[model samples]
Target: MNRRDELAANLADVRGRIDRACAAAGRDSAEVTLLAVTKTFPAADVALLADLGLTEFAENRDQEAGAKVAEFAALRPGAAVRWHMVGSLQRNKARSVVGWADQVDSVDSERLADALARASGEHPLDVLIQVSVDGDPKRGGHPLPDLPRLADHVARKGELVLRGVMTVAPLGMSPQQAFDALHGAVTRLRDDHPDANVISAGMSGDLEDAISCGSTCVRVGTALLGSRRLASP
Candidate 1:
């Protein structure tokens, strides 16, 4: 089969998974947005995914994402894909990220929030607070206790909107346990900012568990795009 056919099959399977997961959780399937993580994949794949009806895509690194974003736009000028930053980001890259990303899903600190706000133009950049369910610094996320403060900062900060929370279930712990904690964090954040409702949890591996715990968005990469290509440009 051709690459496009393979991607179409993968997309359908992933959507089926989301539907079944949501049904089991007693939630509406429409509540979950399937965010295609196009990291390390070529812009051509992004264009194919876009043609296949994926409106949301995410990247882990700014350097790679920046070029792919430009290429994808050139390839499909009218495609309405929402690019998202889903990896640990440095403060210095904030300026460049705002140039491409529609939302940053890994804002973990007040300093990062400030950088993004200052770099963003007149329009407010939507953001999700990254929660460290396991308090692992290497992975980059704010501890549960810090969510409220960071949410407030992002909400009140210039040109930045606190959309919600995002997290990766730390290895060695059950994904369910990690998502349970994240659900609690999201609940508390919502109490303060009701509009902050986007819970970007889960990935290709454990999306079912995340959906059970209230993930409104799932970032699927390998399952959708197959294996990563060796080179990215």
Candidate 2:
């Protein structure tokens, strides 16, 4: 099969998994939004996915994503594609990110939040507080105690909107456990900011577990786009 055929099959398979996961969780399938992570893939792939009805796309690197965003807009003119920044973002790159990303899913610190708020243009940028489910400093997320402060900062900032919380299940821990912790965080966030309801958890590997624990968005890459080709040196 050609690349397009492969992508179509992969997407259908991923959708099936999502459907089964939602059924097992007794949640409405519509409740979960699949975010196609197109990092490392080219604009052509993104355009094809757009044709396949995926409106949301995520990327981790600002440099690559910025170019892809512009390329996608040029390639698929007038298409409503929501760009998301799902990787750790540096303060210096905040302005660049705000240029294209509609939502940033990895605001893990007040400093980063401040930078994003400053960089955001007249329109407020939708954001999710990245929570460190395991408190792993290497993984880049705010600890549980820091979430409230960060969330408060985002909500108070005129340029940024607190959409919800996001997390990656730490290595070695069960996805259920990690996502359950995230669910707790989301509950607390909603108590103060009722509109902050998005829970971005899960990826291609453990989406079922994430759904079982109340993930509203799943960031999928490999399963949808196939194994990533290593970046050229």
- Judged by TM-score, which candidate is best? 1
Off by over 4 Å in 2: 230-233
In the range 1-233, model 2's lDDT, one tens digit per residue, is 98889899999999999999999999999999999998898988999999999999999999998888888888899998899999999999999999999999999998999999999979999999999988999998999767888888889999888989999999978999999988987898899999998999999999999999999999999999988864321
Q: Which candidate number has the best lDDT?
A: 1
Cα-lDDT of candidate 2: 0.92
Global fold similarity of model 2 (TM-score):
0.97
Which pairs clash (backbone N, Cα, C closer than 3 Å) in model 2? Answer: none
Tens-digit lDDT track of model 1 for 20-83 = 9999999999999999998989999999999999999999999999999999989999887799
Weakest ten-residue segment in model 2 by summed lDDT: 224-233
* Steric clash pairs (candidate 1): none
Instruction: Score every model by TM-score.
Output: 0.98, 0.97
In the order shown, the candidates' Cα RMSDs to the true structure are 0.9, 1.5
Model 1, residue 143: distance off in Å is 0.8
Candidate 1 regions with alpha-carbon error over 4 angstroms: none
Count of backbone clashes, every candidate in sequence: 0, 0
